[model samples]
Target: MSEMYKKEVPLYGDLIDLVSDVNTETLAQQPEIRQQLEHSGELTRLNMERHGAIRLGTAAELSMMRRLFAVMGMHPVGYYDLAPAGVPVHSTAFRAIETESLNRSPFRVFTSLLRLDLIADEQLRQEARAALDQRQIFTDNVIDLIERFEQQGGLTKDESQQFVKEALETFRWHDNTPVSKTLYQSLLAQHGLIADVVGFKGPHINHLTPRTLDIDTVQARMQGKGIAPKAIIEGPPKRDCPILLRQTSFKALEEAVSFQNAEGGYDTGHHSARFGEIEQRGVALTPKGRALYDKLLNQAREQLGGTPNEHNAAKYYQLLDSAFEAFPDDYQTLHDEGLAYFYYRAVDDGVDMSTAISDLDTSASQTETAKQAIADLIEQGAVRIDPIVYEDFLPVSAAGIFQSNLHDEKQSDYQGPSNQQEFEQALGAAVYDELALYQRLQSQSLELCLLALDSKA
Candidate 1:
């Protein structure tokens, strides 16, 4: 998908090259961070495309997409309701859950299902639904292979390659659109995102995001590389200890598109949707930590009183930094306060962590005690704490990216209630809880650390 996206969006290839250079430079300058990443199995995957975003028009398409990703070892994790942020869609990121799979290939897709219910015009809603139901996003060959894999449990090497080749076509961009210019404009007026989803033959990948060690640096240098970037980066303010994810993107490209007319010819039009993005991921925070982060972020945004566009970018950033002063800036403080999850490594041969975890009780009343014991283990040099990288999406950030890249004005009042139950039903499976996944990883790493410590002792 990354290769195909690079070919489809030339700017994406440039973004990839720029990220590679920035990552190499960042690692050279911050050897300590590089060492920690290497220890945590994050180093090898840094230079590859981390994720891509695609918007689907129907539940059937979404359900099939889930199965399609399963063949590649990616499962949906975390339900994100972007409606609250004025974007009329709900989404989940599909990626490998296990550490080994992620280390091998961290590629993921942020797939969103369009909410036809959000459209106010009943007539137009029916029309959009009809259009969506009329299209099939997958190829016949890929569908056959999916069934074959389901029956056989696995595909041969040749079959696997064939499946990949056939599947890539599902996301390939087509210049000829299915909908007429009239319906496309109507959808665009409702929400640019709606038009982008319903106007195309397939849900063409909108953006390909590359993980960067220094996103701020990349943002600063993007213009120098002849890439036009959005005014502000979306997410938490920059800090010594970055939390969650920070993302910035190059402006969406305006491409010549041909809309099919009733007379069998086409009318030339243009679309502004595809872009390139870069992300800097930090430690996954505990629920308590996330609550505090959300509070601070909202406070900052409330103070700004509007969207953080180019006009108010500077002031918004200042308010953001001021608000986040309450957040812990160092990893040690984050760990000790239970503000973030950590992957533990047994670092010393002489030190023993067995004593700390032997009576570890995870009951609510003993949770703090268990945490303190782990703290003690670390203080005694028995364990090294590596921050667990946050591997999920934020609803607000996702919506912000869509709004900025889709040529839509902010609709702060356009909020939709979260319908995770409906979304899961359409998904054909329940989405994984992101926080629980991080907690499990932390616990698993601690268990390994305990075993290593016991063997040494």
Candidate 2:
């Protein structure tokens, strides 16, 4: 798919080249970071990691998409409602849940369901609904493959390759619109994003993001490399100990589009859809830590009086940095304060870790005494820890990127509360809680470390 996107968007190819160069330099300059990534098995996947995004126009589309992603070992994790942020959609990221699978192929997709309820114009809403109802996003071959995999528990290698070929058709861009030029303009007038979802044959992948080790460097160098970046990077400001995710993207492409006309012909038009994105992921935070992050972010935005944009980007970045100062800036502080998750391991050259543990139960890590015992192990240089890599998306950051790329003006008009139940119903399953997934991985690492140490002792 990366190759497909690169061919479709030449700038994406340049973006990939630029990111690779930046990663090599970053890994070379920061051996400690490289070593930490290697320990957590993130280094191997760093260069290959990519996440793409698509917006669905209906419940049926979203439900089938869940099934489609399942065939690739990706499941929805974390519900994200963007309506409150002004974009009329609720979303979930489809990705592999386990550590081993992520190390093997960290490709994920952020899929969103368009909220027709948020369209205040009832007539336009009904029209959009009718248009969406008439379109089919998946090929018949892909549906058969999905059912085959579900019924048989797996596909043969040949069948799997065929499945991928069929699935890719869903994400491939089509510049031809089913709606008339007038209808497309009406939807566009309501919201550019609404036009995007309602105007397409399928939820074409608008952007694909490659993982980066140093986003700040990439952001700095994008202009030098002839790419105009988004006005501001989204998410938390750069930190010594980064948490969650930071993302920036080059401007979306404006491509020629043809809309159906009144006489069963086509009318020429233009639309901006595809873009290239880059990300730098950090530790997944616990609920408490996320609250702090939310609070600080809200404080900065409220102070700015509006969403950060080109006019306010500099102030916003400074405000974001200053606000996060209250949060810890180092791993030890983050771990001690329960501000971030980490995977623990016995340092092979350090000590006899068996002597540092009185209990081997993985759940014991939650108890006060067990926590103190693990602290002792770390203090004695018997065990070392690495931050658990965050494998999910943030709502605010996601919304910001969407609006920026869609050229959708940010508005606080959509005040509807989050309806995760509705989203899950449309999805045909409940999304996994990302924090629990991270915590489970952390505990599993502790359990394995204990077993390895006891055997050594």
Candidate 3:
């Protein structure tokens, strides 16, 4: 059954609270919970150390992820895709979490998965399609568990414990199938995993992205380590601006995966599907703030092409600042003007500034106050450029990482243009309200991680 149909998954924190009231003090005494949280923390650290590169090959892979993390008391809240860029195939989905609490730990990995079967070509596409068509992504059992929890509002203490164990055990299953040399390549040709049930091998920790205060440093460091980082470190170019997300990666390592070949044989060989990806996440944007940010990006990209060199980054910022001067910032301006979807604040100074300004030559003076505010902030180091987080993945970058690690880009013999909507519809997912999704996940993550970390002490 689809996740949507299975049952309503409670928002992350509610699910946790339902299981048990994890207050700051109570969590500290729970050793098991503490251990699981530490494990999560370790995963975050690992992602930063190596870069984030995890593969989610199937529905079971996805389900196992939700379950395994739930063992650590996590939940799936948002869905994202990068295929909308519409070029070389790069469709990955993720759930963002606040890795640490403002009062607690650091931020967690904004994890992504490789959409292998969504290739744009034919030969390998068939193989990928065949693999997915033949298998089930989520099991009835997994659905049942989630359903029960959602309905009951919480699992009994014993049940929650068992759920965690089963969740972990499910993902822990590995490809250990024994096979002969002749059959090895055959099975490898047919499937990517040693186990045929899930079709592809079980999911591995693909990438563990760490929150970098300075992505340029990490990018340079990765380069020093011989990893050719991503071409563009996404986000604002200004050093002082708050960068949302800047990511880079070394080449994907040729990690050995259990591959079953034809003639019912198995062999261990390396595949380059997984790569190290690192990111620097910035402040969560309010809905209004996000609109302004996106508009700024669009304006920037239109003025500056794909690879925004240093010169281009500077140029783009200048253009944005100019546009912003003539425009009211964000949805707030839209609301104030009776233009947008969200609410706004109205400041009644008890004086009609419009009437006061109606007589004087105010054209030149109109933007003076706003400009001064920006200048003041900048002068005081209060206003920083909002770094463009890697909100959308670059097709070349995605394909570049895949190509460096894959056998081939699979000879793009695409018959038609890619349809993002069709793909998302099949998954029964909607284009997420980015602002709302980010807030919900971050708030819950802060609550959960803080509680978990506190307990560890």
Candidate 4:
């Protein structure tokens, strides 16, 4: 997929090189961070970290997408409503869920289904649906492979390679438009995003994001590398300990495309939707922490009177920083306050534990004494805790990225309602709660650490 994207968007190759250089420099400058990543088994996956985004036009496409991704060990986690943010889509990220599966290959794809119901014009909505119904995004071979895998429970080596080849065609960009130029223009007039979904042959992989250690540095260096970046970074302001996800991207490319003409020839025009994106992930926030984050974010936006843009970006960031100051910045404090999730591990020193047996008071119950000893060991740095990387997307941030990449004056006042039930009904399965998954990981780690500490006592 990267090779296909690099071929279509030449600048994507440069973006990959820039991210690689940035990662190398970051590791060199911050050896402690590198060590932490190594201990957490995340360092090995850093270089391979890549996530792609695609937009689907129908429920059938989305359901088949789920089956296709299962072949690669990816599952849908989290539900994101982009309608509230003014984009006409709801989404889920498909990727490996287990820790070991994630460590092995952390490839993810942010998939969204276009909501044709958001179109206010009744005639335009019919035309859009007609255009979408005429198209088939997946190849026949890929569908057969998906069905075979489901029945057999696994794909053979030959089948896997063939499946990959067939699946890649679904995401490949097609320059020719299925709808006529007049219909395309009508859809574009309603919403640029509508045209993007209804005008194309397939939902081409729009943007492929590479993980970065420092997004600010990458944003600062984009211009020097001849890449034009978006004005403001999306998500929280800079912090000692980052929370959720921070994202930045280069502007979408304006590619020349050919449209079907009534005269049996092709009409030449251009489309701007695909772009290059970068991300910096932080610890997954618990429900309490996420509520606090949402509260502070809304407060900042309300004070600014709008979203962050070039005119008021500085002031907006200042208010954001001040508002978030109430949130804890240290890992230990965040864990103790039950604000964030973390993976805990027991650290053993060379010293004999028998020498410290007398340190525990024998008068108290065994459970109480063991708990106190574990607390002391944690406080004394005998147990280590690492933040669990946030493996989900923020709806507001996703919309911000979408708005920035879209053509200017493409804003839509979508006052439609969010129908997650409809989305799930179309999805053929219920989406997993990301916060619950993080909580389980944190709880399991703490239980293991307590058991180890109790044995030592």
TM-score of each: 0.97, 0.98, 0.51, 0.94
Put down candidate 1 lDDT per residue, 204-271, tens digits, no spaces: 98988899989999999999999999988999998888899999999899999999889999999998
Lowest-sum lDDT 10-residue window in model 1: 357-366
Q: For model 3, how does the per-residue alpha-carbon lDDT over 1-457 read when each residue is reduced to its tens digit?
A: 0122113221212222221322223245655434433433432342222222344544445444554344333334334443443223323433333434311322232334435454534665555545655544344665566667768767878777666544433333244433333444443453332112224534444343434444566655554444555445555343332424445554544545565667565677544444445554434445565566567666766776543433454565566556545334442233233222221112222323332223223233225563343233333432222211223333434443443334332333333445556444433444344455444543343334223323332
- lDDT tens digits, residue span 217-305, model 2: 99999999999999989999998888999999998899999999889889999999688899999998988899999999999999899
lDDT of 4 by residue, 313-429 (tens): 889989999999998999888877778888878778643444334454433313566546645666776678899999889999999998889854234687877888899899899
CA shift of 122, model 2, Å: 0.9
Report the lDDT of model 2 for residue 68: 95
- Backbone clashes under 3 angstroms, per model: 0, 0, 33, 0
Candidates 1 and 4: which is better by lDDT?
A: 1
Among all windows of 10 consecutive residues in model 4, the one with the lowest summed lDDT is: 357-366
Candidate 3 stretches with Cα past 4 Å from truth are 1-81, 84-126, 134-144, 168-199, 223-232, 284-425, 428-431, 437-457
lDDT of each candidate versus the true structure: 0.88, 0.90, 0.41, 0.87
Once fitted onto the true fold, the runs of candidate 2 whose alpha carbons sit more than 4 angstroms away are: none
Which rank order by lDDT, best down to worst?
2, 1, 4, 3
State the displacement of the C-alpha of residue 320, model 4, in Å, after optimal TM-score superposition.
1.6
